[model samples]
Target: MNAILTVLEIVAPVFLVGGVGFAWVKAGFEYRIQFVTRLAMTLAVPCLIFTALMKTEADLATLGTLAVAGSLGYFVIGLAAWVILRLAGLDMRTYLAPFIFGNTGNLGIPLCFFAFGQVGLEAAVVMLAVSAIWSFTIGIWMVAGKGSGGKILKEPMIAATLLGALFLWQGWETPRFLTNTLDLIGQMAIPLMLITLGVAVARLTPGRITTALWLSVVKLAICTAVGWAVGTAFGLTGAIFGVLVLELATPVAVTAYLLAEKYEADSNAVAGYVMVSTLTCVIGLPLILGFLL
Candidate 1:
C-alpha cells in the first residue's frame, strides 16, 4: 500500500503535466511545436544536461559504468529488434530505431528524480546522454539511411554532455552567478518536455493499433530484460541499477515518429508505436517502480 502511494507520488506529476499539454492541444489552443522544440533542444535541454552533469555528486566510476552498460544494453536491444522485425516481416527502417531507443530524456530523467531523488537523477542523466548520442548517430542512419556525423557533433546536447563530463572529471564548478542562471534555464526542461510530449501525442494520427500493441509489449519486455542483465553484469546496485532499468523500460520516444516523418519512413506506423508504447508505460512503469522501490 505504501509502495503504491510512493509510485503514484513519483509518476503522477509526469503524466499530469503531459495531460495538461494534451488538454491544451485538444482545446484548440496554439502550440508552435517547432519553435518550442528548438528552444528546448537548442537551449533549455542543453542547459539542463550541462548543469545536471556538472552538479551531480555521483562518482565518475558509477557514471562511467552506467554509460558502458547503457551503450551495451542499447546495442543488444537494437540487434534483437532487428532480428525480430525481420522475422516478423516488418520494415526494419521504420520500426527498428523506435524499438531500440526509449524516452530516456523527458520521461526518464524526471521519473528518476522523483522516484530516487538526486542520486537517481545523476544516474539517469548518464543514460540519457548515452541514449541521445546513439539516437542522433545510429538511430538517424537506421531511418534516413545516412547519419550526419557533423550534425551530431554540432548538437547542443552533445556538446553539453561532453563539456559537463569534462567539468565533472576536473572537479570544477562554474561561477555562482553563472550556475544560478543556467540552473534557472535548466529547470524549465522537464516540464517543457513533458508538455511537449503530450502536445506531440495529441497531434499524432496513429494507425495499426493491433500490431502496435503487440510490438510495444515485446519492446517493453526485451528492453527491461536487457537493462537488468547489463546492469547486473556491470555490478550496478541500488538507485543506479533501478534507474537504468526504469530508463530502459521507458516507451518509444516521440522523436522517433518525428524522424520517421522527416525521413519518409511511414510516420503513421511510427506514431502508432509511440502511442501504444507510451500507453503501455503508463501502466508498466509504476509496476516496475513498485518492485524496484
Candidate 2:
C-alpha cells in the first residue's frame, strides 16, 4: 500500500544513517563519541531547537497544550515505572530512569520531521524540551541520588528553548546571516545524532539479554499506551497527536547507559536495555508511523 511505502520512506534514512555508523565502527575506524556528543549537545542541538522554535508557525495555544501534555505524560510514566520497578524488585538506581525516559532527541526528532514535516518537528521539539528538562533534573536525581536542577539551567538546550520560546512569543527573527549560520549548524544535529546512536550501540557492552528483552517489551507497551491515552485525553489531533505518541514511544536512550556508567550502577545491564529497546524500535516505530500517517 501507499501508506506502507510512505512509512518506509520516512524510516529508511534514519536506520540507514545509523547503519553507516555501525559499519564505520565495525570497520576498525575510530570515533570520538564523547567529542561528538559534546558537539551535538553543546552546539548543534541547541541551534536546532532554537531555530525550529523560532521559525515554527504552529499555534501558540497548540504548542502550550503539547508542552503540558508532554510534561504530564512523563510524570505519569515515571510514577508507573517506579511502582513497577519496586514491585518487581528491580534496582531503582539502575532501572528507574531508563524506564521513564525515552530517546526523544535522536530518533524521535528526525522521525517526526520525516513523517509530518515542519509541523511535526515543531510539536516534537516541544516534547523534546520537556523531556530534556525532566531528564536532566529528576531523571539524574533518580540515578545519582542527587538533584541536577542547577545543571538544567546551565544546559544549552534549556537556554535555547527559553530563548526560542521568547522569540516565538514576540514574533522576532534573527538577522538573515545569523539565522542562516545557525540553520547550518542546526542541520548537523539529526545526522550526527543518528550516527552517534549507532556508534554508541555498537560500543555498548550489554548483559542480561533475557531480562533486557522482557523489560524492553514492558517499556514499549506501557509507554505507547500512556502516550496514546494522554494525547487523546488532551484532545491533540493530526501531527500533534502523532508526534507526541511517537516521541513517548521511542526506545531507552543511550544516555541512560552513560548515566549508569557515570553513577556506577549496573552500566552493563542498562546497556542491555538500551540495545534491546533500540533494536525493537527499529521495527516498532515504522509500524506506529504507518498508522499515524
> Per-prediction TM-score, please?
0.98, 0.98
In the predicted model 2, the residue pairs found to clash are: none
What's model 1's overall lDDT?
0.91
- For model 1, how does the per-residue alpha-carbon lDDT over 1-293 read when each residue is reduced to its tens digit? 88899999999999999899999999999999889989988899899888888998888888998898999999999999989999999998899999999999878988998999888877887888899889999999999999966778888988998999999999999999999999999888889989999999999999888889999999999999998899899999999999999999999999999899999998999999999999999999998889889
Worst 10 residues of 2 by lDDT: 284-293
lDDT of 2 at 91: 96
RMSD of each: 0.9, 0.9
The TM-score of candidate 1 is 0.98
lDDT of 2 by residue, 41-121 (tens): 999999999999999998878999999998888988888898988888999999999998999998899999999999998
93: Cα error in model 2, Å: 1.0
Candidate 1, superposed: residue stretches over 4 Å from native: none
